[model samples]
Target: MDRTPSFLQQHKQTFQRVGAVLLAILVWQVLAMAVGHQLLVPSPLSVLERLAGIWLEAGFWSTVWFTFRKIVAGFLLGLALGLGLGSLAGRFPLFEILFRPWAVMVKSVPVASFIVICLIWMSSARLSIFISFLMVLPIVYTNVLQSIRSVDRQMLEAVQIFRLPWAKRVLYLWLPQMKPYLISACSVGLGISWKAGIAAEIIGIPSGSIGQMFYDAKVYFNTTDLFTWTIIVVVVSVLFEKGFLALLKWLYGRLEKL
Candidate 1:
């Protein structure tokens, strides 16, 4: 009964992305050939070869797990605190005023400065957690506060008039308004968390971390390893972002149905 396009025809965006990636790889191959130096610019194939075997190497998964847990812990802490503080700020103008200066300071201060300062307070092994939390906190806080402040007064009045239960009020009223802002915050915050966390690890050089591998690669001038690790970071970050967003959207969808 349907007269729709073919499956491939429906996936135009996917095909375009594949084509773009292939073109980029081709360009990289050409540039590597022109350079004629593996140390300076390894070909895509070389990086791929390294990527294929990097997982088999000792401590690879443990290193990845170490960084992953730290980054995720930081992100979750930021999200929880941001939402809680943002809710308080949205409800009370005085609280917002008191917190404004601190938020501004955190937002304006450089990440390197924060990392160096934090190192004095904590060990290198735990540096990524604080760095990622600091990086993500302001973003989530700002987005959440804005979203809450922008809620329609008329909708709030209606909920009160109906005398809805607190759970229903949140699921039916607040969640819808907050969904977009929260998703946006999470998307941006997740990427920043990874980048900042990795940077901290690199600077702190915690043993058996992906960032430590990056530092080692730089110290040894292993361009192929550097590129391979870069690819791994990108792929992992993208995958996590996609999966988290999908789950968030799904949760919102299920909540809305209730």
Candidate 2:
């Protein structure tokens, strides 16, 4: 019998989730009808219609792709830098001290302030990339560094005593030890990257971006368009997180099997 849990058993909850979503949408539709103003709150059907319209347009995919590329670029860059810096910080007190202030500032300062300040240094063209990077860096770095620092000392002593090969040390010692923190960091960082990237694009209004569409919708008071685009962002963000986390977990499973 293939008893392995191929994935987390969430299938049973699917019906519940669908019911909850339907209920929420019903509530929203009723509220919108009571308001009697599309501008105030668009009906669910109208928003779905708007979504269909946008989906049929040629530029829709292009807009989604552009924003996706920018956000992913920044997210990967931040994740790479964080992993590197976190390793250094974990190993050396001086390195950790040097990074503490920067990490703290990145986590503490409002994202809007960073977006504005970044405008002075770079054009709006790359605003999303930079903003997303800034948003994700501290989170990934902090989690990874803390994980490394808290690695089981006994595990390390055993590895040293056995004089295990570097490959085994990494595969056996590090991956298992750091998997939870790594997953946590990625989960949080990915969400922040999307939010910050979109916010930056909204403020900067770069051409051909999802954020620009939002701005145009707001300018014309197109509630349907706004709601449609907002729903797209949420769906895309959620899907990306789920896909990426699943892939990471799958890889971890393979490592464990080894």
Top lDDT hit: 1
Candidate 1 Cα errors over 4 Å, as ranges: 1-8
Candidate number of the best TM-score: 1
lDDT (tens digit, per residue) of candidate 2 on 217-237: 999999889899999999998
Clashes of each: 0, 0
Model 1 TM-score relative to the real fold: 0.95
Q: Against the unseen true structure, what C-alpha lDDT does each candidate score? A: 0.93, 0.91
- Residue 170 local lDDT, model 1: 74
Instruction: Locate the minimum summed-lDDT window of 10 residues in model 1.
Output: 166-175
TM-score per candidate, in order?
A: 0.95, 0.93
